[model samples]
Target chain A: MKRNLRIMVIDDENIVGKRLKPALEKEGDIVETFTDARNALERFSEQQFDIVVSDIRMDDIDGLEVLEQVLARSEKTKVIIITGYATVEVAQEALVKGAFDFIAKPFKPNDLRTIIEKAAKELGR
Target chain B: MNITSGEAPIQTDDPQFSHHGLGEEYVEDIALKSRPIISIRFRLFLAFLVIFAFSMIVALWSIYALSEIQVKIRFLEAAGNYLTEIQQARRFEKNFLLYGTNLEDSLEHLRTAESILQKNKDTIEKILGRNSIQGMSLQLNNYHKVLEKVGEAGDTEERNRYEPELREYGGQLVSDATNFVVKEREAVEDALSLSRRVPFYFLGILMVLIIVITSFLVKNILSTLNRFLEYTNRIGEGDFSPILPKRKYRDEFSQLGLAFNHMIRELDKRHKILIESHKLRAVGTLVAGVAHELNNPLNNTMLTAGLLEEDFERLPDEEKLDMVQDIIKETERSKVIVRNLLDFARASDYKIIAMDLENLLEGSIRLVHNRVKLAKIELQMKLTPDLPPVHGDEQALQQVFINLILNAVDALPPRGKITVTDSKSSQAGFIEIKVSDNGPGIPEHILPRIFDPFFTTKVKEKGTGLGLSVSQGFVRRLGGNITVESRVGGGTTFTVLLPTTEVPSSVSAAPSP
Candidate 1:
């Protein structure tokens, strides 16, 4: 029952991706890091991911567009939104766009793991 | 001018706040409407007027005197000419005898008389010219005609007729000259009298004017100075009273007074606003402190009740009612905390009363005793015997003492010691209550602002930042003051001073009670 889950880590800050990837992988999900949203789009065409943990505020293309692209590719993929600048409206929009949950930056690894497990359970349904 | 927020008051509304580098706000209000320059300018004008009047009088006197002297000289010259004319007439009579019945002798006599007449005419012309009189030349021509007729009389009959005519003309001339001299003398005398009296009159008038002007100037200056002195006294006494007295003169002093009054009024307004805002901030801090104090006990009651309910579920049925009673007791405790908070926060009309300061201190200690025991802090109380009563609100004074004691207990480490001592102060004529604690002392940078609202030294969630600020407010309301002495790693001591009075009232209860 172990599924190969494609998890995309989209972060413009190099340190966020570098630090978060290993920790997220420790939760037993495959993680791919992409600094550029455009390159991430090209990669998305070749492979499909189970969850996208992307930073919402990024240069050029934002996480909302990525979420839109991932949903168009496959409707069942669960998106997990993360950002340092969290506001009520943004959280509402993420839920409306079919994101599993929204997590603010500076969160502990345990909080992220909890959200990932919940999202995985919901996806199984 | 003072503004306050109902909750979480952070700033005071004061236009002249100490943000511009001035240490504390010292406002001086001076009205610009009253000034002395106006009176001074008016006095100067009066002095100038008096001097101008005196100069005019002197000028008039000089002109009158010079004219009178010229008149006297003219009158004397007229008298002298008249006497000379009479002498010449007598000489003509002698010449007439010498040249009797000879045409040449008569001609010589007439020619000599003609020469004398010419001299008289020249003298009259000279006098007339000086006086600017016209038409006197006609009289000279008539005299010359009479002289020619006398010279032409060669026979005895002609001589007799012409001699009588010449003598009659001479007599008329002498009489007219004498009449003119008499009139001129009278005119000269009148002019001299007027001239002699003019200096006296002029000097008298000048003296009067000088006195009036000098007095007016001094009066104006003195009045203005008096107003300034009164205003300065008012300012010294913190009154900011009016700086100008009413005056009628429209001058520069009036303008200066207006400006000064405006400045003073502005300063007064600013000062009043600052004091009012300070009071509002103090009240806000008081309410916030009470609210914060109640919140901690309320939280404890909730936690204690929850623990009791959980323990009840595990206990036997026989002890279930007892557990409910404990819950009820905690609920009552919570209610008491809320009531104390409300009473402390309630705005009451301030009324003065005799306060037993030692009893108030004991009451405050009793209120905080439970918390001190819960915190496991040692408490000590040392009150000097025969401490006098003060004048203030019992509840407000108790609240201040409670706040300070609670703050001391909060600052202490587990099992730390707190000492509160009270003694009569001889120098201050009051009682001094010192609350000292063996806790970590406050930092140097934060010591000055300990009484400022929203300033806290304790770690987050342990302190609400309004205790000392509210305590300071309550002490100030009672006409008392609180000061702190502290150093890092050493204990802190807060000394509160309350003025003592011999007014007995309901607050002078036994300390143990």
Candidate 2:
């Protein structure tokens, strides 16, 4: 049997991280949630994750910076960007900047689950 | 996805708006209409006619006086010739009496004097009266008879008797003639001198009249001009009071006042429309942020409820209650976001009240929070605590700060910095707030025109260029001012100085007597 996936979620909206924790855990994965992107990034620096999900906009730092730092640490880890009022330009820029995929806000857990599944298959796990 | 419309609609409040120029409009209209028309041209004509009529009277009087003097001169000349003739007869009488010359010569001279008197008798009568002329004629007749008797005398004794009578008559008649001529000459001289002085007095009176008329006309025109100047300044300050007639008679200036009132009404109407459109534009900009902000809570509620539904059968009752509570909290958050925006978007009359600047700034910060986030710009606030309250309209001042923030956001690149700081101003009785941005500064050449209406550096579709202009207008109306400083490479800062409200100045703040 394959090892369980290590996943991380970062959103300023605390509920986004709270709800996602249990939902991803149900799918036989280890999920760590953070309301602060800086804290999540600090934790990422100490540990390794198979995937990192972050909101595009936040108070202190943005998701794109988080994406850049994560990719710099380990290029193999996949990054999924979450955006509110997502425009075409932002989505295209996220893809060009090496984000695995971009998702608009108010998406169901299953929708994120599908994108994660595709990333997981690419990892061959 | 469609907005959650199932919940009871939240918009129950009225849209606050009013026609600013419509107050007391009918009263002003009636005041302008209740006047008679009299053009300035007619007034000038009337003034000229008065002067013309006065000059004609003076001219006629002067002509009559001169003609009378001419008649007196002619009479004096005739009377002088009659006097000369009488003196010649007297001299010839002496030659006849002393040198024993022929008495015919004296008689001839006396007869000539009599003929001269006869020729000028009617004129002399008109001048000296008919009674005086008859007296002079009687003396002349007696002198002539005495001279003729001497010519007819047969011996020396008869001639000697006539000689004494001739001498008495001759001396008396000549004296009377000389006295009449001298008196008439003096009278003619007095008339001539009077006629010369009459023209000088008329000129002096004419000068005084011209001065009076000129000052009357000039004062009317110039004072009206000065008043119109004041009206233009009033309009510039956004006062749209119509001009009313101030004079008894309506003249060209009254028509001009009416024209000014018409222009004021039109300008006021246009200004109201511009303000309305500017508000709508501001509302549009705010709505986008509101819509984006609304999604967060909606998403939270959706996720919480959706998961709760899917796990309803498996989840514990405590967990279900927690999910329901989360859903409630998120819905409530959405309501607050919408309400704040709605309050700003609604129009209201100018209501100046003592307001807390710090609290107002916080509200404005919240309105532009999402825009600031989306642009990836860092916004900081350093408000002075317990600052003196300022008199201002809440909605208007809110719009002003939002415009400043949005403009800064537009100018800044991602990761740029914006700091909003407030402090006591250098000028007393004012508080200064500065919105500074670390964006590529505006070029110096176009900086002066940034607040001009319809002057824009932004693209045509993206901007109507009224944001700064309208913001400045609002601030100025509140007894405040907005200023800007920028460099080519250095960042830009907009400083707003607002007047602090003094205690007990407001009508409501004052204690009743």
lDDT of each: 0.63, 0.81
Model 2 misplaced regions, further than 4 Å: A1-3, A42-48, A72-76, B1-26, B29-39, B84-138, B141-156, B182-216, B244-249, B347-361, B375-394, B400-513
Q: Kindly list the per-residue Cα lDDT of model 2 for residues B269-307, writing each as its tens digit.
A: 565566566667767878988988888888788778778
Question: Candidate 2 chain B — worst ten consecutive residues by lDDT sum?
Answer: B1-10
Error of 2 at B160 (Å): 2.9
Candidate 1 docking class: incorrect
Locate the minimum summed-lDDT window of 10 residues in model 1 chain B.
B1-10
Instruction: Show the colliding residue pairs in model 2.
Output: B16-B347
Candidate 1: segments with Cα more than 4 A from true spot: A1-125, B1-44, B86-272, B283-292, B313-349, B359-385, B392-513
The backbone clash count of each candidate, in order, is: 19, 1
Instruction: Summarize candidate 1's per-residue lDDT along B49-84 as a digit string, tens digits.
Output: 769977886898688678757956764674555546
lDDT of 2 at B69: 86
Q: Write the per-residue lDDT of candidate 1 for residues A13-125, one digit (tens) a residue.
A: 55445545655775567889898888887898899888888767565577887888888998888888875446789889988987778887545555666788887887782
